[model samples]
Target: MEELFKGVADPVRREILSLLRLQPLNVNQINEHFGDISRQAVSKHLQLLEESGWIKIYQAGRERYGYLNKTAFYSLKEWLDAYLQWGEQSLENDHGVFLEPTAYEKGAPLTHPVMLQAMLSKDKEFDGLFYNAVRTTGIFCKPSCSANPKPDNVTFYLTRDEALKNGYRACKRCKP
Candidate 1:
């Protein structure tokens, strides 16, 4: 746990983690994002993260890129789960157990109101926005959110029926 914290304690390490989450990047590209830091400093921070098992560095082209090693985050999750489970039990004793298996038990489906209809009547802006919004959730989309991503973790839908069926919600701005 201390090793994990140590790897994450520096601002440079946090920036590296954020960048790697988006995509693997070479040390030079990573350094480009940090104007104040030298390439050597960025390399050192990347090295620490690599040593702590939070990142991986490998040769690509003529340079090495850094990538997030997601498994290390699982270790941090295990540490946090110990205390979270205790709190859950305490809450169960104080109130009644939340027996519901799904957290979205109460959320209503999007109505796709007249406003959405008007928006869709335009040059398919609604569909384009809805598709782009789903990308933020890391899902590949379809004309109608047709389970294109296939896997539940990545699938998203536009219609309330589709979203409710596959467990997605309307975008607050797009209101799919």
Candidate 2:
């Protein structure tokens, strides 16, 4: 947990994590975004992030890429959930793509075909009928989330707990 806190403590690291939330990026591409800073500095930050498990660096051919490891956020998510259970104030996320889904209750699991349809359509009716977890991103979201992850990377869960237990974390955007 201390590591997780340190991982997100830096402004530059937070920005890198935010970027990874959207998509994976190779080291050079990540460095390009921080033109004001030396690449060595960014590399150091990446190393720390990796040690903290917030990001996973891998060599994809000759280019090394960084991927977001959402499971690393699970502790934070649980802490937030505890607050929510205590009737703490909710945050209005401007980047959120789904809102109505939060008002619903979790439903039974649906068929794979049905889940696929809901995913593509972003069907609000199926928001709690099933959870859509993206393996590539290691994040799970409500069916109504507007983000379009590849179908090949998606899996279904009957409940958010089920998804979390399987090593996926709730989507920050959807907050599922």
Candidate 3:
């Protein structure tokens, strides 16, 4: 746990973990996702993450892929959850700040799909059924969006559970 905390304390390492949490990526692919960083720098970060047991590497085809090791996140989750509780209270006490509906309670498993294939029901209103955020622009989009959606690298979630189940965090602005 100490080693995990040490590795995640760095901002760059956290970024790497967040990316890996989405999907496995090889060294070159990870570098491309974070285009501003030098390849060598990303490699060093991956090395530290591996040493801390936060990530596992496996060979896929011609390249090595890195995956986030869930067990290593246990301690970090506790630390963050402490504040998450406080944030919930703060929001409840102050209606001045708008709070989006959370898909899950702390310590509970996610309930939404990562990508949903459901055809929109004709009668369901778009109010809570469809959601997209400006930050995810060009990423996964709903059929209801006014813009052109991106490639398949992005995904759709049927329920909040499916999204959380697949490790995609909730959007803050346009809460899905």
Question: Which should have the higher TM-score, number 1 or number 2?
Answer: 2
The CA-based lDDT of model 3 is what?
A: 0.61
Please give, for residues 9-45, the per-residue lDDT of candidate 3 as tens digits.
Answer: 8999999889998899888888987778888999999
In candidate 3, which residue pairs get closer than 3 Å at backbone N, Cα or C atoms, i.e. clash? 111-161, 112-160, 112-161, 112-162, 112-163, 113-162, 113-163, 114-162, 115-156
Off by over 4 Å in 1: 86-176
Between prediction 2 and prediction 3, which has the larger lDDT?
2
TM-score, per-candidate, Cα-based: 0.48, 0.49, 0.44
Ranking by lDDT: 2, 3, 1
- TM-score-wise, the better of 2 and 3 is 2
Best by the lDDT measure: 2
Worst 10 residues of 1 by lDDT: 95-104
lDDT of 2 by residue, 46-116 (tens): 99999999999999789999999878887778866644543434454322223233343455345676678
- What is the TM-score of candidate 2? 0.49
Report the Cα lDDT for residue 55, model 1. Answer: 96
Off by over 4 Å in 2: 86-176
